[model samples]
Target: CAISQEELSHARDSLTSAQSALNNIQQQLSTSVALVDDTVVSSHPDVKAAAAQLRQAFLANARSTLVAPVTGYVAKRSVQLGQRIQPGTATMAVIPLDQLWIDANFKETQLGKMRIGQPVEISSDLYGSDVKYSGTIDSLGAGTGSAFALLPAQNATGNWIKIVQRVP
Candidate 1:
C-alpha cells in the first residue's frame, strides 16, 4: 500500500494545524491560571472596595426606614412623598397619649388660686363635656405671655393701656 503525495502533504498540514491549536489552548490556560494566582480571593483591594460599597448600600437602605422611639399615634406629619429630608429634622410629631401634659395659658387673674401639686379637673371640646380628665397642676408660669412674646408690644410709642396678660 502507498499513500498519495497530495494526501501526505495534507496530513502534514493537519498535524501542523493541530499543533498550532494546541499551543493556542495551552497559552490561554496559562494566562487564566496566572490571573488567578496574581490576585487574592476576597482580600484584593478592588474586591474589598466593592464589598464596602455593598455594605454601605445595605446600611443606607436600612436607614431609609424610620422607626419611632415610643409607641404613639403619629400626627402633624410634614414630610411629603419623594421629599428629601435632612438629618435631625423633625418630619412628624409622635404624640404618645400616655406621656402627655397640658400646655395651657390662662389669665393671670385665674391663676391666682392655681398652685403646683394641686388637684385639677380638665375637659376638652374634642370629646365634649362628657369626658373629664383629672390631673394635678404641674407648675405655674412665672412670667406673663407678653413678656415672652416673639414680637412684644413696643409700648413706648404713646398710649399707656393696661392689658390683662395671660400666664402659661
Candidate 2:
C-alpha cells in the first residue's frame, strides 16, 4: 500500500529514536562489563582490598583445618582446639639443639672495660666449673637496663643528682 510522505517521515523518525535508545543501552552494557572485568583483573585499590579479603578468608579456612609444615614429632603441644593464636605469639618452640647461646647480664660498671671482640669467659651454675664456653663480646647495650625500663625516671623538678655515665 502506498503511504503518504508525511506518514513515511514519521515512521523513519520513530525508527531513529528506537535506534538511539538501543545504542544507549548497548553503551551502558559495555560499561558494566568493563567494570566487572576491572574488578576481577585490574589492581585498583578496591579490587586489591577485595582480593586481600578473599585471601584472608582462604587463610582462615585453612587455619580452621590445621596442616603441619614440617614432618616432626610434637615435642609439646600447647594449642588446643578453639584456642586463639595471634600474630607474633609463640605457641611453642622447636629446640633442635643445633644452636644455643648464653645470655649474661653483666653490671654496667663491668661493661665499662668490655669492648667488641673482647674475649669472654662464661661460667654457668648449671654446669659448674666443668664446662666453660670461651666466647667474645658480640655486641654491647646502647644504654643501661634502667634507661629502657617501663617506668623511666622523670626529673621534672629542678632537683637533680649527678650519675656516673659509663662509656665502652
Candidate 3:
C-alpha cells in the first residue's frame, strides 16, 4: 500500500508539472495574439504600400474619364470607344465658343502703342468691311510663333539679317 501511494503521488506531480507547462505555453500564445491585435492594419508597412498603390490606380482610372477643364463644345473626336490612347495623344478638341478670342499676330514695330485691354477693330473675310467687331486685347503671347516652331530655323550659317518677330 505504501509503495502504491508513493507511485500515485509521483504521477500527480508529473501531471501537475505538465499542466503548469501547458499554462505557460498558453500564456505565450495569448501574448503573441495580443501583439497582433494591438497592431493596426493601416499602419502596417505592407498594408500601407498596398493602399498607396490602390490610390494611384484609382487616380489612373479617374484620369481615364476625360473631363474638360472648361465648359466647351466638342469640336472634334478622333478616338473610338475602348481605344488605347498613348500619352500626348490628340484624342479630341474642345472649343469654348463663348471664350473664343482671335489671336492677332502683330509686328514688333506695331506693339509700341498697343497694350493689354486696348480696344481694337476687327473685320473678318466672312463679313465685309461694313461689319466691324470691336474687341480688347486679352493677353499677349510670350514669344513669336517661329521661336516655338517644331523645326526652328537654323540661322547660324546663312546671311542672317536681324529680323524682328511678331507677337501673337
Best by TM-score: 1
lDDT of 3: 0.88
**Candidate 3 residue 36 C-alpha distance from true site, Å:** 61
Winner on TM-score (2 vs 3): 3
119: Cα error in model 1, Å:
1.7
Q: Residues 89-116, candidate 2: write the lDDT tens digits.
A: 6565454443444555667668758888
**Over 4 Å off, model 3:** 1-73, 80-91
What value of lDDT does candidate 2 attain over all alpha carbons?
A: 0.75
Best by lDDT: 1
Question: What CA RMSD would you report for each candidate?
Answer: 5.5, 16.2, 12.7
* True lDDT of residue 151, candidate 1: 98
Task: Encode model 1's per-residue lDDT on 1-168: one tens digit a residue.
Answer: 999999999999999999999999999999999988777789888989999999999998898888888889999999997788989898999988777789899998898788899998889999988999999988888899988999968878799888889998
TM-score of each: 0.58, 0.39, 0.46
lDDT per residue as tens, model 3, 63-145: 89988888889978999987898999999999885677787888888888888899989888897898998888888888887
Where does candidate 1 clash, by residue pair?
none
Q: Name the lDDT value of residue 161 in candidate 1.
A: 88
- Kindly indicate the candidate among 1 and 3 with the higher TM-score: 1
Instruction: State the lDDT at 82 in candidate 1.
Output: 71
The full ranking of all candidates by TM-score, starting with the best, is 1, 3, 2
